[model samples]
Target: MARLNVKPTRMELANLKDRLKLSTRGHKLLKDKQDELMRQFIILIKENNALREEVERELTDSMKEFVIAKSLINELFIEELFVGSETNVELDIHEKNIMSVIVPQMDFNIKEADVTSDIQYGYLNSSSELDEAIERIESILPKLLKLSEIEKTCQLMADEIEKTRRRVNALEYRMIPQLQETIRYIQMKLEENERSSIVRMMKVKDMGTNN
Candidate 1:
């Protein structure tokens, strides 16, 4: 925090008083904004916690299904197999801004991956279970992506909230107090100066009357 310049004179006292009032008003407004942001941030944190638990549970279930499918495929006769052609899965990426912070957007063409080339290796006619597993994994992908989005947004909001909180505290606890103290100092000096002027005027008047 930078120190405030408080070189005030009687001529500039009115201006300082007005500025003090404005600063106090601005401090109140910023404090209100900070409080609101904190409230929202707390809510977001709780939501993020719930989403994390859900993703963990879903991933556990998915891994179990994956292992079962793999074991079944390995047990099947080798002569009854058909091999499928592989294709590269391309992902499109974009950026979205949330409160001036940029976040990533990912697009996976799962529909394109659905079309598989015929293969010969197993007695089974098709990889229906494997396809189902792939689809399940694909379904979970969007949820995971959504979770990432939520987490990042919450992080950005938290950062802003903390910054706002610091400014509010500085204004409320430090800046305003120092400004008030300076105002008091200037007021006291002006009062003393006024009393001295009155005393001098009375002394000069008495001297004139005597002469």
Candidate 2:
């Protein structure tokens, strides 16, 4: 590795050694964070997949039932039956940190949240299929929200892992090696200077004895 372009002095060597120690420690910590983040990300990905599958499957079934019910009833009457059924959904959004990366957390509450509370039509105007379909759709709402949170968390963690990998690579491949090489070069220069000083002193002593 290439040594740093620094003066070959004892003070510079000490400074380089201190930097190397900090770099090594920081590298290890970043590496560990990357590993743990990967583990958590993998688990979240699996859960996201499973939850997505479940939500999609239920949504598909409910849509089929809804289509059948629509065909069985007059279109305009269907609209009339379910009119003025709007309810406010309160969303509580916040963040949580994982390995120093912030990810989203969301909680929601539907006003007066009984799944069938909005069914205002009389029994004579609706079929079993329509009621069941609406109920199923309502029931899956929370799961859909949860699935969104997991997917978003996975995305954030993936980004964090990539960043940590880059930092670890920088310290491992560049900074640490440069410091070590510089330290060795300075030590060699110091040793050479000590030898030259000893030789000069010995010559002076020999000349003095001859005089």
Candidate 3:
């Protein structure tokens, strides 16, 4: 909106012109980056939403099975059932770069070697409902880990996109305009100075002829 306070000269004008060109080019690059970031962010969001829905559905089913099993058995026995049973899930996390944003790539490792023996309780006393519930829950661990990874990536990308948008807007609305205005002002001043010099030269030549 305002021209920069600079000395009016051809040199200044040339410098301003170069700056304006650079600023314009930078603006285009930043705008393109912002657009591409948005595209990737949207794709991640969609995947996060879908994976979340599926994980929630599976969790609900697992909870239902547990509830049914609890109702059919003695509540005291249910507490003792899983007293000695435990499964450790470990996350092997790695970083991935997406459009300059670093996101987590998660892999879950189940510690127990024998998947079937994960149920520490004796089968004779455990209800079929309990078994199915435990199995389903164990199966969901990897998906849950994956869901976390995607959601985290989405969050990181969203942050990056916001930062990029602000830079683009600053260049487009502020820096570029100010540089262009300053360049124009310098060019006009230089032209006026040139005209004044020509006029002075002509007056001197006329005076010499009159003498």
Question: Per-residue lDDT tens digits of candidate 1, residues 1-211?
Answer: 3334665577667766787898899898888777777776688689889989988898888778766766667544323232343334456868866444455666755443444444554445335666566567667766676677678878777787778778888878887777777777778878888999999999999999999
Off by over 4 Å in 3: 113-124
> RMSD for each model, in Å, please?
4.4, 2.8, 2.5
Clash pairs of candidate 2?
none
Candidate 3, 1-211: lDDT as tens digits:
8878999988888888888889889989888888999998888888889999999999999999888887777766677656646688888889998878999998788866433433345555567787788789888988888888898898888889889989999988889899988988888888999999999999999999999
Q: Distance from true position, residue 16, model 2, in Å?
A: 0.7
Which ranking of candidates, highest TM-score first? 3, 2, 1
Candidate 2 error regions (>4 Å): 112-124
Query: lDDT tens digits, residues 124-153, model 2?
Result: 677778778777877888898899889999
Alpha-carbon lDDT of model 2: 0.86
Clashing pairs in 3: none
Error of 3 at 93 (Å): 1.5
- Backbone clashes for every candidate come to 12, 0, 0
Off by over 4 Å in 1: 1-8, 75-110, 114-116, 120-131
Q: How much lDDT does candidate 1 score?
A: 0.70
Best by TM-score: 3
